[model samples]
Target: MSETLTLPSHLRAVRAAIADALGIDETEAVPEATLLGDLGAESIDLLDILFRIERATQVKITVADMADLLQGGIPDEEFGDENEVVNDTGLTHLEKVLPQFDRSQLTEPLTADGVLGLFTVRNLTDLLTERAAAAGADAA
Candidate 1:
């Protein structure tokens, strides 16, 4: 990463895994970079990256977990309008939960499918680290 990230070890592991999965140097995986878009990660890369994260951090995050984090448990109908455009409720929740979401950059009519584009390196790291913390707390 060009900007040095003072992240916890587990969070650093997320970036490392992403870089490895994409066959790029570790420094390329900036936190703000969107894995699917900026890093050119496909669906298969995500699975490999997640598995690597699990091995390194002991936090097993499935694809469904990432989807759930993005959707915030909002039902499909509630997340989007009848036209399948992201509704106000979805927008509000997304902004509140994801620090990376910049409302200004978004054009209108953001479809429900487009939300996945918001998934960044920081987002994935936060998800795995949060789950790892929760698992530790549960064990304690």
Candidate 2:
């Protein structure tokens, strides 16, 4: 018997948007996986993906939102030192925000740069879903 697909509607739409941004097949965009590592998305591709996601979901995702998520709700300046090295407290916050990644794989001296690697397809979907829900609530 052929099994019906059970992915959430928002997740499927987000996956398709990511696939289109990355120029990859939709089948390769797994929700639980990292976009940069698993899907071979470059840093430059992220802007395009974000634009596509916003258009597809009709949600306005701001740079501040991305920064807050990346910094675990902490201000960017507070998350690190002048050299951009993440302190212990920042590491703890990062662990909380990006639980999808293996913390053990992080470099000995973690920097803000490493956080970029933690963003996953699931994260994007979650952001879009949350924003869309909030927008719906505001409209209603």
Candidate 3:
């Protein structure tokens, strides 16, 4: 994670917030880095990061919002099978939205929790920027 100033302002703010939440160097919050897999961000850290993001961008995105966006309107029962494993339909949706995730790495069925590995910093930045723009539009 080399120090660089080439990132966009929103992305810079995201990286900074993530790094600050996780107690890591800002450079460690690379765009492609997975929040859970690469940076070891836990659920609590996510809350802290979101708080920081809201403070920085004035756009709030709750964890439930993230879950809904990830699900893409799929029902909770359909999103996960009876065994709580992600079904083929769920996998398809995940692959479509979370292209950063390597599905081949799964040696067994992917649980809902495993999907967190797909959430990269870039995804957060993109989602946040979209939400911010929508907020601005509403304000207008």
Candidates' C-alpha lDDT:
0.86, 0.77, 0.86
- What are the models' TM-scores? 0.91, 0.84, 0.91
For candidate 1, write residues 95-122 as lDDT tens digits. Answer: 9878989677787778877788789998
Question: Which one wins on TM-score?
Answer: 3
TM-score ranking from best candidate downward: 3, 1, 2
| Overall local distance difference test of candidate 1 | 0.86
Instruction: Return whichever of 1 and 2 wins on lDDT.
Output: 1
Superposed by TM-score, candidate 1 places the C-alpha of residue 30 at a distance from the truth, in angstroms, of 0.7
How far in Å is the alpha carbon of 112 misplaced in model 1?
Answer: 1.9
Per-residue alpha-carbon lDDT of candidate 2 for residues 22-138, written as tens digits (9 for 90 to 100) = 888887887677877788888778888878777877788764576678786676678888888887778788778776755577657777886776778888878888889999999
The TM-score obtained by model 2 is: 0.84
What is the Cα-based lDDT of residue 134 in candidate 2?
Answer: 91
